[model samples]
Target: MKDTPRFAPDDRPSGGWGSLKAVAVSMFREEAPISTAHALLKQNKPGGFACVSCAWAKPAKPHAAEFCENGAKATAWELTDKRLPARFFETHTVSELQTWSDHDLEAGGRLTVPLRWDAGLDRYVEVSWEEAFAAIGAELRALQAEQAESVVFYASGRASLETSYMYQLLARLYGNNNLPDSSNMCHESTSVGLKQSLGVPVGTVTLDDFEHCDAVFFFGQNPGVNSPRMLHQLQDARRRGVPIVSFNPLRERGLVSFANPQSPLEMLTPAQTAISTQYLQVKNGGDIAAITGLCKWLIEGDDAALQSGARRLLDAAFIAEHTQGFEDFAAFVRRTEWAEIERESGLDRASLESAAATFAAAKSVICVYGMGLTQHRKGVLNVQMLTNLLLLGGHIGREGAGICPVRGHSNVQGQRTVGITEKPELAPLDRLAELYGFEPPRKKGLNTVEACEGVLDGSVRAFIGLGGNFVRAVPDTQRIEAAWQKLRLTVHIATKLNHSHLLPGEVSYLLPCLGRIEIDRQAGGAQTVSVEDSTGFMHASDGVAEPAEDTLRSEAAIVASIAQATLAPNPKVPWSQWVGDYALVRDAIEATWPEIFGDFNRRFRAPGGFQRPIPARHREWKTDSGKAHFATPADLRTDPDTPEPDADTLRLMTVRSDDQFNTTVYSLDDRFRGIYGTRMVLLMNAADIARLGLAEGAIVTAETAVNDGFHRAVAGLRVTTYDIPAGCAAGYFPECNPLMPLAHHAEGSKVPAAKAIPIRLRATKPA
Candidate 1:
């Protein structure tokens, strides 16, 4: 960790010369040829490969450069010319490699071939694909003989829909439904909450809905860094004079203003478009109270309006016809005192009422949120409360009105749609049985948190990761990594080396796979895969660049080969045939989900693809009540699972830097926040720093504010003052993941409460 971080407040708006310079630097750092970069970037358009970054929807009418700065970085990272050959592994032992930082480890570049950990040599050794599959098959078969539930199949969101479909199928055919993916860590709350209220697990809005929306309400989402492509829509909405309201703990730069790099006029001139018409700095874990305040103000105003013989404030007809439990929700909101709402939300009554005035005046609105709302103890409640606010004004199932949960990975939602889930009811097991001629598993599977528990208890013997650095991404990182070594078997299908790969099991294998930007050649000649965006629209993605290594296989082929080697010759599942042509995979998906993915191939071939059927979008509720339900929060506090923190405990939230994507670090700089050269700094409010009697740049140790008998702490973090709310602190993710307790998760969704970790800081001696 650096002793002093370069702290320069950036007054300029996001996405101008800074973004362009970052993109160019990434290309140069990866040694990507200018021509090759241009060609690959051009392919990020409609018919080309999807950006393996955020899941923001692409426009139907695309621009020449449709990619964002982070998108370009992801492309360059995948298409890097650097390669890790057999000799590279021979020189670096597993123990030695474990000491390297994540960025440096991946900078060694793409894995060229299959490699297996040799206990005798204490290093990884190259192995043939046939031998690798045979060994993995033997281990899986042995594990299945004991208990199929002992194995875990983890999938990453970067995979294509075809690959995810095949991967989930392989897990079920082997006997258990222990399938967990990236969604378990991020948007599981959105899925669980929306389904119970709106009768749909996914968001109802489309990209076109942004066009007709009268106002946009953003909750805890920083689009400039997480999904830069979304800035284009916000810019357009701003130009059209639509009001944008933002609710977050920190005053994020993305929500304040933006200068689109794609705009020649803005780039040439000093013009920058302001994004948020109103920015409210809510306290961490205070969204429920903030939303409740809005609802209360609206209902009171409605009462006064009706008594005075003015126009009805709420859509009374829509509420009566399309919703239920409104009276109970309204009663609860009306009873909620103003003092509690103001204290919890960290905003005055005047501000919330003023914001509510804007919301009530708008005819239609789009409520958008991100992981900050979903990664808390009362995550499900937070989502349902936001939905309740929309229902008050009948802002749903209409042309510009709905809830939008902005997802991170490109195909995360698609993965869940295609059956990468631990819940059996979510997947059509009966249909899968009819299609595959085998009975699927009926018992529920372990989710990510439960899987970690299983691994710790020695119940889960093996783990097969489709893609991702699971060990680094999960909470209680140190504990999980120690338990991971005791596992019997571990298999990672990856494009490049990461921290998770270095933590090998007793019998572990690292198999190289082709990245999204590279050409995937099979017997079908050239294949195109599909991914569902955050807006529920599905589209085709085919690579135009050459593969980093010819021996690297596609993710679909690898999963298919493993299935073939492990399972008996099942006539229904022609694994090899499906591997030869990916259309067979799509056909099988369509057969399994005929209602949603009807005519999968034909529809995918259409320009800009088609939207998946969302029942709630048409005002058709699939719930038991057959109507959208207004769900009241269990209590006012958003962090209900954990006890209220003491006065000194500041809630800590993990965030992503501008130069990073999820767990992948492109550089040490957080350009948007103006913090450079280090990620080990803690962001705190100036008042909190003074109250805690800590210096501006003092070295500190943050310990978990829990009585769980576990000593969880991270030391040597330099404290830097920022514009965060009092009693709140912020730090980059994965670095702060270790401080979170694995058991501290959402009650229903089970997503780790990363956004509201209670911690108290103490000054540390200078290192």
Candidate 2:
């Protein structure tokens, strides 16, 4: 890979020959062309495994080739034939491995057995499963006996719902609510914001809603790279003449247009379908201002219509019957100055009015968003403002309109649904007390940000990860990696070796686990685990491929074993029995959350699975007042506490490249962005580049603009001119995560504000 990226303008539509070529390259690189091809056919099929990529909902009527380009890469990456035996670790010291890139570390291959860190040798040595489990169990028990809060169990969204349930149960059974998962870092703001407004934490829109909606509004989401499968739905909606309006800082190629690789007509003719009919380049952290502008335009238009005795623009009936706080919300919008909105949003009033016209003309609309709207200081407010825009037209609970927060992981939503949260109120404590014969923890626990703080402060002594590279995913990477070594014990149950594995604790163990694509067999026959999609659809995923290694254990089995070893002689939990038959785990889940998972085993077996009930979908608000409430933003500024940038300062947002998933870089190239061979690059507007006296391709350094007393910066980043807001910049995540301070996060959700970090660039001489 080159130190500097090769740049070119990629005008080709997303997901055509480029996508097919990328998929082929991924398969070839993994050296499993035939097996990967077979896996692709089975992906997202009714009887096949779910794609271990984005949580985009699978269509009710499945297509022959349901998986997308990135999905294929994820599957091939998982099913790679490469193996990392004990000898490989023996040859590499921990210090030596720490110098490797994240991609190089994970690409080394699947872990073949349990390994324990040998402090004396400064390397990892193979250990028996029994010994590893016993040691981990003893360490956890010791921690629990000392202080349950001293230990933290972190889970990734990749874990199955069954496994997640057992993992959370294990934590609660040990008498601590310190159960933080991947959602805390991504969509916790959505969960927090939507719950307060719509009274439901999950999205209200169903897959079928796309077909009925007249217009689709996209805010800060790039589906083509993040959730490629969604392009099919967008393409279908576009073909049906639905107008799509997008508001994002970057004019993402996926939102501009897409070509379906599966469509013979498109692939053969190289034809493309337009995605966003209107694109508004909102400034970073300006989503709230933009959304508030829309609401203001609509509300004022309705007032003028009433004066002229024209048809009412707002939904008077819905507001009166099913909502509260409308008068206050309307007053707030009416009083908000248009000039402030324009300046902050980086959009003229005409664009917002035009967007409002499109939105008001449509009988129904769907508002879709991603982390861009939910990873700010006021991320919750940003989401609530979008909800406010949807509420003006009575979009919520309608057949064709609602809010959709596109989740990243395959089962991140499911992990939260199955009780993998730090909040005690979200868990079914009453049922757990009755079933397990023990009082569950009632105190709130640490989230991702707080967990990092605990580790840094030496309050957290042990760390257990079910599946994820925690150290690579979190902010303040250098600090967290160093603090992680101070832990008394660290156990990672994973399918492959990642950077997090190299950051060993005092008594660290790496337990190899089965990937979702691989069959999970137990004392019973082959078992199936369920996952919930972004749309709250619960479906079973049957692993069609064989395990990479025979000694690997299922995540459920590993969690069960850990629980059994830690809390033995407790008959009520039945950890061994549940692990033997996953159906037993489902039974416990059903009994615990009967309202959502009622008839779990039976419903999971049904074709296409069942949709979990979303009360807001039926106008049944679950708020304190039992009515949907419009939330008034404290101010138009999304980051009220953040100081305004000077002439050289810019709001920098960390993003995922086309060739990468969360913290998992498949390659150094970001094809869609026209970046190749390097991840160390900064995307800046041409205007800003000239204003800062920096030329395109010039080496520069981005320093945090905040006065946090800590000098945070990333150097050796090549500047690339792009069509972005003048005062905003873009860079890939994990690399840019270092610029984000641990103290900078959403006020309520605690999600790191990676989307809008205040930064200033300085020219650097090339080495």
| Candidate 1 local lDDT, residue 471 | 92
- After superposing candidate 2 on the true structure, give the runs of residues whose Cα lies further than 4 Å from its correct spot: 1-4
Q: Root-mean-square deviation of each candidate, in angstroms?
A: 1.3, 1.1
lDDT of each: 0.90, 0.91
Kindly list the per-residue Cα lDDT of model 1 for residues 1-767, writing each as its tens digit: 53455888787888999899998898888888563476555655766888899999877777778888899898888888889999999999999999988878888888999999998898999999999999999999999999999999999899999999989999999998999999999999999999999999999998899999999999989998999889988999999999999999988888999998988988999999999999999999989999999999999989899999988778899999999999999989888899999988888899899889889989989999999899999999899999999999999889998999999999999999999999999999999999889999999998999999998899999999999999999999888988999999999999889999888889999999998877789997888899999988888888878888888999999998899889988999888888888899899999888888999998986666789999998999999999999997756887755667777999999999998988899888888888988888899998998898897789999988887888888888998888999999999898999899999898799999999999998898542
> Model 2 over residues 482-571: C-alpha lDDT tens digits?
789999999999888889988899999999999999988888889999999999999999999999989999999889889878985778
- What TM-score does structure 2 among the candidates reach? 0.99
Angstrom error of the Cα, residue 412, model 2: value is: 0.8
